[model samples]
Target: MGTETETAPLELDDIQAGALRGRPNPYAGAFLFLRIDDPQDGRTLVRRLAKVVHPADDVTDPLTQTSFSAAFTHAGLCALGVPEESLASFAPEFVQGMAARAGLLGDVGPNAPERWESPLGSDDVHMVLVMLAPNRPQFEQTLELARVTIDDLDGITGVYRQDVFSPADGRNSFGFNDGISQPCVEGAGIPPTNPGERPVKPGEFILGYEDETGSVAPVPQPEVLGRNGSYLVIRKLYTDVAAWRRYLRENASGTDEETLLAAKIVGRWPSGAPLALSPDEDDPELGSDPSRNNVFLYGDDDKGLKCPVGSHARRMNPRDAQVVGEIRLHRLIRRAATFGPALPEGVLEDDGADRGLMFAAINAHLGRQFEFVQAQWIGDGKFVGAPDEVDPLAGAHEDHGTFTVPRRPIRRRLRDLPTFVVNRGGHYFFVPGLSALRWIADLAD
Candidate 1:
């Protein structure tokens, strides 16, 4: 890790709030995609957006109720007439976009880009606007503010929009608590939620700062357009709630066993209590406590007795468990929210509802952070010493996969695991800083 002498205080006022801060629980948000038909119009839209988008420091304001963040696709940058030299400086994955690398992300068969929704991976998608608020009214108000930026602008067109919200219970479509275990960014002024968490270097998530390797990563030049910026990976995943529940029921013997099976697969109970801390049963109190819920490490449970090494949460963040690579290098700031209606509880049959999660992974290095986690961790199980296993909850299981649960006397192994999550569509975006937004808007022909 970088020493204090090499690290500097973060420029919170220049950075976008979404890149560092956690969203409010039970929040209302929307993601809006846009296409730039003309460079001048796109610049005008960015100029207006720069005014409403909240800075990282805005979270301290008591009156602040909404946050607006703006990001541009590689094609969007080109549409705005970014110079060739500057464009070449971006991460190669971002330049190629998410759809082009679908295979690496396990987006094959049903999740393939060819089957993705229109305008998502296409070149027509140039800009993305994310609005988040604590309630419906505030969310709508922020949406209106964003709409005005492109109102009557013939060159800028709205492509797609997804309304997302966190349920009162804070569980996702799969009935497990989401958005837990985020890496604390150094000098972000926000203390670690868990005492066991060591704050990661700011450069790991924001540009122009020293990363864990004690070196500053090369940002897209000129520095004004890249400093304090970060990469935003947006993916729309559809969770098959019915399928997940059915698998649990079929794998276990009874009601108590069924719930245990579900918890084993996720590495946590439905209430967010991790198995490492509450091994026997669901502890709602422990799960609700932010400080204690994510405080446990996997060093003691290396044998997969409590939380299986191949479980969804464990694979995502190994946390001192001696995984294939250093866990710190792959840490990501996730801001994911559930979209569509929650399936009525206890319904094992398919409801045929288009419900899932809107996942946004924030980081400075696209290749080593977001893409690495997706391709190597979630998509495969080689890192955890389970070469054939994958993340049971989010992995692309093709109806023939298996999951092993370590236990006393005899171990339990689940066979024929079906794919529970499907990739609907997504894109890689470059979230520029406040000054960079203006620089982009003020670009000359």
Candidate 2:
């Protein structure tokens, strides 16, 4: 974001990918996840959507999402009549040559859904782009943009709204701020990663880790580097703020309860001082300050004792854990929103409700960062220290039930963890390039 621009054609990293792939302004939005069904399915989707799609392994090229796919814009939708070849490559300099080809030109409209900035990072384009507008005309214009995207895709897998305007104060259910701590891609500042942590290894985050047998863990064999694509985690988290608040009001917070509990659960206070450093008060200003939001970690303080052993902040990203403990570059670049109805004045008088966050996590490894955080730190009682229970905020599990601790006198235990947050639904989806979409569109069922 600083004046730094790549002289060479920069292939989009996770964070940067989010910035380049969307139309400038959208009134509404949605996060879409797609399954190819099989390897052949993956290949078929590639043909039609190739223009906007980028392959993960194309790390060096820096195109949106490193692949090609349809860009839902009014003009783009209008251009459907144009030749696919022309729209395939958006390089203006090459437009002349592309236009010269047959089946490359089409009718572009007054509003074409083009890539402006994306969620994961700037270099990549988002899978879905929705618009929310002020008036009906605007709505109709944006609806056309959405229509273009819908027409191009296979079908809607799942859809959920994310925001925090009252009823949707927090995540719908997964607990904690879903996209609160993602790392910004080198170029496009996104979910904002750990401040001092080194930039993730070039392809290390997206590509699957190699094993003794040279086989990747999750799937995709021949597409080895294609494994370069990040594993996308989408979860519908419903927040029960009333419940979250009720527990706090009733329980005594040992002076550090209210704020500490929040940071412990969110891994950081609203001010951004990681509980690792400032564990006591909610530095509202600090947490609110973008520059200082994610500034500290386990090492800033001399003893690293500022944050407790199992505190969410420490468990989430023990920056010094690499030096003292075994925590690695477990940062996830999240892109999500808070959703649901706004709490009425009456509800506000009591507490917010029917609100939650839609979590869209992008990471190279699920078993590591995403899953590990949920299991070890959030769900596991033995995360980084002795006798600590799961993360009070994000660690609610089905089989394991609620995990609690007595940080003060060490007498607390997880009571039936009143379902403050609920996991409505979610899944893993792959966002291919625009070219990939075209390939699929041309597919015969």
Candidate 3:
């Protein structure tokens, strides 16, 4: 670990609230993608956004108001007249943009950006506007405020927008508990929700700080532009809930067996109880307890007797489990929300409407953290001792995907698992620090 820096008061006023804070309520969330029609006029709109944008210091401010955050795509910065030399200082993957590396993240064939719903990979998308509130009305109120600011600017064009919020019981579209495991950033002063996990270096999630390697991460050119900033990867994933449930039903017998099969595949019960502790059945009590739910490690279950080694949870975060690389190097601060309505009670047929998750992962080093997880961990199961296996929940399976469940008598092998989740589209965004926002808005050229 890096030598600890003096714990000074973080510039909450200079950091965007979303990069450091979790959603206060489960009711409302939305995103807006915009294109820069004119550079100078867009900067004028940005200046307006800066004043109303939410800061990390929300506790003392007006409590009833909604929260908003803003970020830019690489092209957005270029459109705003940020110099080419300055832009070159950013990470290559980000500059190249998410669309260029879609195949590496496993968005190929049917799931490629060409088939994406809207302005995801196109040059048209330049900026992203994020809004969150306690309810729909408040959310819209906040959205309108942003809309009104850029209204008639003749500098920006609305490309696409999507609203996302948490479903009941913290379950995703797949009927399993989501967002249970998240990393804590050291010195961010945010209370650690998962008790057992140690806090990672702030540099892992924010700029101008030492990372787990005990070294400061490289900042983009012009110190103010990169300081306290972090890379944000936003992905729109569509889940085939009915198809997933149907597969389990066909493979396993009875309710009891079906539940177990689902648990094995995800490495957690529907209630979020990890198989590591409550191996046999779902324990809602343990699952709901914040202090206990995320406390277990894979030390005792290296062979995956309790949780399958290649299961979704284990692969995403192999806590204390033996792994090939430095675990801390690839950690991500995940802030995700489910979109689209849930399918009816027992219905296992296609609803046809779009439904999935608006996933956002924040980290300082985009390549080492978010991209590494997607390319090496989520897309491949070989590192965790499962060769040719992919994450059952998120992998873009082109070939016959398989998952092995260890049992006392014999191991159960799930073969030919169809792709359960598909990447509809996504992008690499630069969530600037508040100072950067000011610098951007004030640019002369």
C-alpha lDDT score of every prediction, in listed order? 0.88, 0.41, 0.84
Predicted candidate 1 versus true structure: per-residue lDDT over 100-219, tens digit per residue: 998888889999999998988899999899888888888888887877778878999899999999887878988888788989888998878777768999999999898887887778
Q: Please list the residue runs of candidate 1 whose C-alpha ends up more than 4 Å from where it truly belongs after superposition.
A: 1-6, 61-64
Instruction: Tell me the lDDT of model 3 at 341.
Output: 91
What are the per-residue Cα lDDT tens digits for candidate 3 across 1-445?
1244524456777888888776644558688999998889878877877788778777632224466889899999999988888899898888999999987877897789999877887778898988877677888788788878888798788899888876766688888777778788776667677666798887888877878887877788798998778898999889888888888889988889989999999999999999998999999999888688888888899889999998999988998888889999999888777899998767788889789988888888888899889998998877987878889878877885888898878998899888888888889999888888888889987
By lDDT, the better pick of 1 and 3 is 1
Sorted on TM-score, best first, the list reads: 1, 3, 2
Q: Tens digit of lDDT per residue, candidate 2, span 276-303?
A: 5456666666654547666655555433
TM-score of each: 0.97, 0.59, 0.95
State in Å the error of residue 110, model 3.
1.7
RMSD in Å for candidate 1, one decimal? 2.1
Total clashing pairs in model 1 = 0
Ranking by lDDT: 1, 3, 2
